[model samples]
Target: MIHFPEIQSEIQFLTKINEVELHILREDQIYPSISGNKFRKLKYNLEEFSKGNYDAILTFGGAYSNHISATAAAGKEFNTPTIGIIRGEELSEKIAENPTLSFAQKAGMKLKFISREQYRNKSNPEFLEKLKSEFGNIYILPEGGTNELAIKGCEEILNENTREFNYIACAVGTAGTISGIVKSSENQQIILGFPALKDSGFLSDEINRFTNRSNFKLIKDYHFGGYAKVNNELLEFINDFKRQFGVTLDAVYTGKMMFGIFQLIQNGFFPKGTKILAVHTGGIQGNEGMNRKLKHANKTTII
Candidate 1:
């Protein structure tokens, strides 16, 4: 019920140096749930479904994936059946085991699983063939819920407020969203990406293949650890961020990139007083369990 429109430009940063301000995209501020770049990407993906009748929309996600949750919400919104191909096999587990997964199931999404290795080959012919044979005529969504069509929706995030900054920064995962942001971004604003995956070793190639261009750079060292992994420093920053800004930070993706941004600023990457914008792509649903544990840990420490 957190209306993001009201939170527009709500996340302001007064850096310790020169008191420079960095604005946060916090696109998820409006919905928190089913908000963020997911809503943007799905707005168009499901628009055609509005006209045509389909049995279901099939997408991929990890055990606790924001994309899966958003896809379920979109399916519910559009009155379409959704099937989530989760990456691991835990279908028989109790709902109490994983709330985010349960929420997706409650949204009426059927869950399927492939091995970790098979998941790596999810988009390959053998996998799609197996899915098509099993599910029959279902629409396929790429892992991380990113696709070329998703770009059209993702780019719209910057439309209303353009040319407001000299640079734009976002956390990149599958590169679809970042590539789209880079393409539609004002040429004047330098778009930079801090990846949440280790080394992002192949990230530049992934973006080029996704966007068919070679105009971007990837800052790979920001991952801290591999995707969905975190460490002590991130938790410290998340706590300090809450104390300072009153906004909770999730560990996996946004926190790492945010930590990277602050470090980059300290390292003097951006010119003094340069205007910069950072996108707070949301995935709070995945954090509910992690936060609970973290809070207990924090309390235990205080005790």
Candidate 2:
């Protein structure tokens, strides 16, 4: 049996924001690679994989996907060979330029590159069949690893320690994490999801597949132009947050969510004495790659 390590979740207070007392659920401190929602999302997936007699595990991700990095680390520790089908065919030859891909490769994940057109067909029967033919019989984990099992794992994110918060907030990606949060939350706790992407219309349906509750909301204004897109304001906020709170948030997810939380508090969105909890979904490793991109664009880097 594979022994998965336990992660410590703690609460940190942000003091005041328009008389609102903010708390942070430091999910990022879970582990270096398998941290935050990635660890929560994979907890049960790995167990299911181990139960089956699968030879290797295959998953999908982009050039800087936190999911890709975490899966590679999990495969390494669990002694399972892993394959990452990365988007953007051109990245196949430029692995060195990408920190996330380089880390995955070093962790022993075999890399495959396909065009964005083909990647869009990743769920098609024929496309999956082709992958099986090439990689052999393998356990397939979806991009972001957001299946039913993943939501089950994520449900564990909230526990007795978090029951005091009136509102729980998290950065949304594939919606699996927030869906689990919504299902596991108390009846009075309102869950707020800050999407890191532009078009999150599909998240409502995807989340509904696993949850029947309407206790959650998706805030879309904080995306900062879309996925992977950043600006000087975000960089300043991330660096300032690191200095002030001693937590480094990735520009893609956690940073954006925190920014939105602060904005809402300042705009008088929350009640005066509302107690809010924001989740820190870790993806700090990808910050190096993001910093490199910012440098290339001649913009300020995230510390």
lDDT of each: 0.73, 0.91
Error of 1 at 219 (Å): 1.7
- Writing each residue's lDDT as its tens digit, candidate 2 over 25-49 gives 9998877668889898888888888
Give the Cα error of residue 266 in candidate 2, in Å: 0.4
Q: Which stretches of candidate 1 lie over 4 Å from their true place?
A: 1-16, 212-215, 292-303
- Give residue 118's lDDT in candidate 1 (0 to 100): 76
Q: Residue 292 of candidate 1: its Cα lDDT?
A: 57
In model 1, the Cα lDDT at residue 151 comes to: 82
lDDT (0-100) at residue 211 of candidate 1?
A: 65
Using all chains and alpha carbons, the TM-scores for the candidates as numbered come to 0.88, 0.98
lDDT of 1 by residue, 169-241 (tens): 8888888778888777775677778887875777777777656554456777778778877667777887787
Q: Give the CA lDDT, 0 to 100, for residue 247 in model 1.
A: 64
lDDT for model 2 comes to: 0.91
Q: Which candidate number would show the highest TM-score if scored against the true structure? A: 2
Tell me the spans in candidate 2 whose CA falls farther than 4 Å from its real position. 6-8
